[model samples]
Target: MTKLLVTGAAGQLGRAVLNHLLETSKVSPGDIVAASRDTSKLADLAAKGVETRKADFTDEAGLAAAFAGIDRVLIISTDDLATPGNRLKQHKTAVAAATKAGVKHILYTSMPNPDKSLVSFAPDHLGTEEAIKATGIAYTILRNAWYDDNYLMSMPHNLETGTWYTAYGAGKVSNISRDDCARAAAAALANPPAGSTTLTLTGSESLNAEEIAALVSKASGKQLNVVHVTDEQLAGGLTSAGLPDFLVKMLVSADANIRAGNFDLVTSDFEKLTGSKPQPLSGYLANNKDALLSAH
Candidate 1:
């Protein structure tokens, strides 16, 4: 069995990737190492017989030790939205650790169209991708599209006020579920393809802001309204939402990129890798509708 090391094990995507690997792939629990900053948070995974390690991206020595004896490592992008450059350091640490431990394959989850793509948080991902390329290890880059779960917080607000706000204008986004992304990651982790490959994991179709509003309205039985705003207003709103200045700027910039048609198409890359078509927006709405409706 190929040993796989998964970073960010406590996160939603990481958990789903491990679960999918257990259910759908040939990887055994004994061959998996789940790493996180908080080892206590991974007690359940440990109980399942998988080796659990505390590997901090900031701590290179620990990472190198944990990566020992692993064949592949999945580098889940860090969540420090305010500091994009910091994650690059973390990724570099992990890369060096993998190199030291002689790991042959490394899977990285990155943002789609990250090369001067103008998306919020694209620079860090693009930089990390470059670093991974420099590492000389075989790499598989899953350039994940916008996640459907991003709507979760907005769903409650939209349902409550019957208004959905965005800076996307008429630009389309092939939003994908974090679960499908996880499945794709699991598939890649189980079998890291030859060479450095980049795949854009997207949904089955593309939907603009207005189309999503319509779908959300049907799912929630609400009079949903689509309100397109300027990036300035978006930055202000994010600031009011208590986001740091850096994050507010990042989000506004991403909206600008969306309006520029950066994330505006459907891709079959997910299906090509997973052997199954990605989920539809309606399916996500239906499955998550109850929670969205109840939230406020």
Candidate 2:
């Protein structure tokens, strides 16, 4: 049995991937290793007979030790975006540690069109991809689309206010659920391809901001008017709304990326990896109607 390791196993995506590995892919629990900075958070996984290790991206030597004897490893992108270039450095460290550990296969969770994406963090992903490829190890890079669940962060407030502000003028985005991304990641890690490949995992359909607002309105029985704004105006609004400087910049850049049609893409890679169609955005909204309506 191949010993598989999943970094950041305490995070939402990491936990989801581990769940899919055990329940969907039916990988033996003993063959799976869950690594996180705080191993205490992974006590549940440890109870399931999955080996748990302390793997901190900032500590390259520690990571190599944690990756010992692991054949394949999934490096979930770190959320160290507060400082510019810190995230990329963390990723490069992980890649180097994996290479040193002699890991046969490596998997990564990335964003779509990183090469030309306007998102502030695109460079981090692109640099990490280059580093992984530089190692000459068999790799699977899953360029995941924006998560439909991300809207939940601000959608409820928008629904209550009956106004949706966006700068993505007529630009469409194929939003896949985080769960689907996890499923695809698990499948790729469990039964990796024979060689290196980069796959963009996306939803079955793409929808623009107006279409998205309409779907949310219909799902929540609320009147949502899409208010188009300039990037500067959006940034000003976010800043006034008490968002941090880094997040404001990141969100604005994401909208600009969408407006440039970078995220306007659909692919069957998710289905190809998981053998099932990704859940539609419309269905997701409908299923989470109560949460959408009550989210503040």
Candidate 3:
């Protein structure tokens, strides 16, 4: 039996990938390994016969040992966005471990056009991608777009304030659903492509901030307006709004990326991999309206 391990299995994306692998791909639970920093968190997966292991990226030896006997491993990007270069270090360690363990293939969840993206998190991804390529292992790079639910982070505030503040002036983003990204990653893991393959998984529609605001207005029954501002102004506002400096910078960079048109490209890779159209923002908002309202 081919052994496959998914890092960050305790995270939402990791859980989605594992679920798709088992329930949709019909992969044997015994053949899959669900690894996280805390193995105990994966007890449910373990109960289902999926191998559970502790694979903390900071612990190099432990990470290598976790990859032992695994044929292909999916390296989900860490959520530690506040620390500078910490994620890159973790990714490098994971790649080194996978290499040392002689894993055949290394799959990574990355941002769309990391090399060209203006998003603050882009460099870490580009660095990880370069590191993975340097290892000379067969690789699959899934450049995922921003999740559709990401917009919902502002929904609560918008509902109360009636204004959607952004720096993305007339720029469009092809954001896909987190579930779709996970499903595509799971499908790729179950039947990986020959040699190195890089796919950009994006939503079917490319929408601007105003368009998103219009959708929110329709969903919430509130008059929502997009307030476009300069990047510096956006940073200042978010910082004054009680957000941490690091997060303010990250969010500002993401909007700058949108302004630069880095996220405007639409692709059929998601459907090509999952055999279904990517979910639309309307359906996503309709289903999660209540949750969006409570996000504040």
> For every model shown, what is its TM-score relative to the native structure?
0.96, 0.99, 0.98
* Tens-digit per-residue lDDT, 121-186, candidate 2: 999999999999999999999999999998998899898889989999989999999999999999
What is each predicted model's overall lDDT from 0 to 1? 0.86, 0.95, 0.92
Model 2 stretches astray by more than 4 angstroms? none
**C-alpha root-mean-square deviation, each candidate:** 1.4, 0.7, 1.0
Query: Which tens-of-lDDT digit does each residue in 161-205 have in candidate 1?
Result: 787678988788889999999999999998767787989998878
Identify the leading candidate in terms of TM-score: 2
Error of 1 at 258 (Å): 1.4
- Give the candidate order by descending lDDT: 2, 3, 1
Better of 1 and 2 by TM-score: 2
Q: Please write out the lDDT profile of model 3 over residues 2-109, one tens digit for every residue.
A: 899999999999999999999988999999999999888889999999999999999999999999999999999999989999999999999999999999999999
Off by over 4 Å in 1: none
